[model samples]
Target chain A: MASQEIETLAQALARLPGFGPRSARRAVLHLMKRREAAMLPLLRALEAVNERLSTCDMCGNVDTSNPCTVCADPRRDVRALCVVEEVSDLWALDRSRLFPGKFHVLGGRLSALEGVRPEDLSIDKLLRRVEAGGIDEVVLAMNATLEGQTTAHYIAERLERFPVRLTQLAHGLPVGGELDYLDEGTLAQALRARRPVS
Target chain B: MASQEIETLAQALARLPGFGPRSARRAVLHLMKRREAAMLPLLRALEAVNERLSTCDMCGNVDTSNPCTVCADPRRDVRALCVVEEVSDLWALDRSRLFPGKFHVLGGRLSALEGVRPEDLSIDKLLRRVEAGGIDEVVLAMNATLEGQTTAHYIAERLERFPVRLTQLAHGLPVGGELDYLDEGTLAQALRARRPVS
Candidate 1:
């Protein structure tokens, strides 16, 4: 009976991104024994987030407000937009503090195999935002993968009639990454996209 | 400024049991971008657990009550006691669904090098509970480590005068563990502690 309860809890925990059945079982047992310390808190947090959270209408990022903090901020540059596959990509770019522009989350990459088409993503909304004018550049900061590249090319082509300048993040050896450690595909891409020294 | 926030969040996340700084940064960014979906839930859980949580006075385990559910339950075998070091350990044993007895949490092992003395742990409470009588057996289910063994020995010596039987979990090769993969210490100990087949 106790194991049944544990199994149910484990299933619930397995719904988390990185948690599998084994990890879920470990976590559930860990939480149950430390009920006062972790379980109740986690439960409350889940409930609270479920009740209070919303999606940012502009960026499609999850937030407590309709327009997220970044979208609502008047000081942020609206004309320079960074495009990404997911909110996680946007967060990664935000953490870099290199770009001082707004973001457009595509929700997911264009995956023909996965049946994700252009309309399935936020591409229509992105086109509308860009065609509204005043936007100078669109930085395609999607992952350096086939689906990411395909999505980027598709978006770029869609905006070909517009006056917006399009660009992508440089493809090269990552910072502190060794060439020997890099995968063959990445190495090839890095070599192919190499730029001449100034 | 954004990097600093990410760093701070990463540090906070790194304090979780299994995560390191790199994983913490990844988790923090994931949370931030999925603020509504993940971060808000985590924050609420933390707050709820912090606010509503309390430790069981009897066993030093975390619970919503003073004595805790285990201690309060009349169905549990009070005369058979299982001893463990941390609250997490107790929870682990509980999930096994074998023991039907009450528990005594020692809180920590006896580490002479670390200056963790018998008095530093809940050894006094353990002695008191044992001395109060009615206990048929006291199972020392502490981890199979030097400090844990030392702590178990101390408890055994203290209860030598009492009529209660002392027992311990069998130590040997773990289930599904290969003999070739066994560490030298574990192999040696297993050989030394070998028992005849019933």
Candidate 2:
């Protein structure tokens, strides 16, 4: 018979994004088998993250510090700000190490179907950051989805009055993308944005 | 920038049986977003399970109690014991509520490729439980895999001198399984084990 505590643990794991009931059951069994080698270390790591978890006051990024690592890093380009829809997006971009700038996580994109509006997000906080000045450019690095574009457009309109230069991520065929496999919209965008041979 | 604590949490999650690096990152971000609603409860549950986790001295099953819920249940049939390769198999069988008997977890199947011997499993403990007397029958409900069958055969031979009756699960088409989709071995086994229409 499954104990109440083990069932409770499985239920909690099932609530996570990717895990379903079967996978949660398997994971719990796996953890129970390797208590010292796996479960204890994971428990300790989770406790540490939970205890120190904090949000960046200026940029809405979740981290263990008030200003977050990116915001507090003096070596990062203060003049360039990358605005993203969520902390996951921030992480994905930061992982590439291509952008040497601070990030502002908007929490989520504006979704009309989901009843999300400007006030629901950290848009005002983003505006306030720009208003405080010294940022030379604001890159709207939102996703290419309908809601993402809508949110980016809304933010661009709001930042129109500011002195900072506004830009968005360019749309094009992805690296190693086969022309036959690419969608029509992507093909059109790639053709329109085609540059002279380098 | 990803904090050390967050990275550590992701790495821990990645080490789980089904999780990869990408899914681990997504899970961490999801947990961070709903820290109070999700992460804290999971942490508490893990801690609770970890604090009380114990191996059943009787059946080699894992539970918060030494005897395990199944072993301690007086309503269960003491004369019949279902033998399985792992705790997961025990849980799966018990979940069906079809087995009124107790269980004997073998810990793992004997495998020549992996160098697993009979001594590596809880076969001795199981034999001792039967030798102590009371069991009228032993059901070898091992998996259909080669190693599982090999282990079952070995155990059956060892228990040949005992007073108890020996039995095994039937090989047949799974409930709702299509005949055309079945493997040749499974079809052959099903044909070989065909019973009366009644």
Scored on chain A only, each candidate's TM-score is 0.86, 0.93
Error of 2 at A122 (Å): 1.7
lDDT of 1 by residue, A1-198 (tens): 232334445564454455566665566446655665656544543444445456688888765456776788788888899999987787778767788889999999999899999999999999999999989999998888899999999999998998999999988788999988999987988899878998
> What TM-score fits each model?
0.78, 0.94
The C-alpha RMSD in Å for every predicted model, in order, reads 4.5, 1.8
**CA lDDT of every candidate:** 0.75, 0.93
Give the per-residue lDDT of model 2 (tens digit) for B1-198: 688998999999998878999999999988999999999999999999999999999998999778899999989999999999999999999989999999999999999999999999998898898999999999999999999999999999999889999999999899999999999999999999988999
What is the C-alpha lDDT profile of model 2 across A1-198, one tens digit per residue? 788899999999999888998899889999999999889989999999999899889888888778898889999999999999989899999999999989998989899899999999999999999999999999999999899999999999999999999999999989999999999989998899999999
Off by over 4 Å in 2: A176-183, B179-181
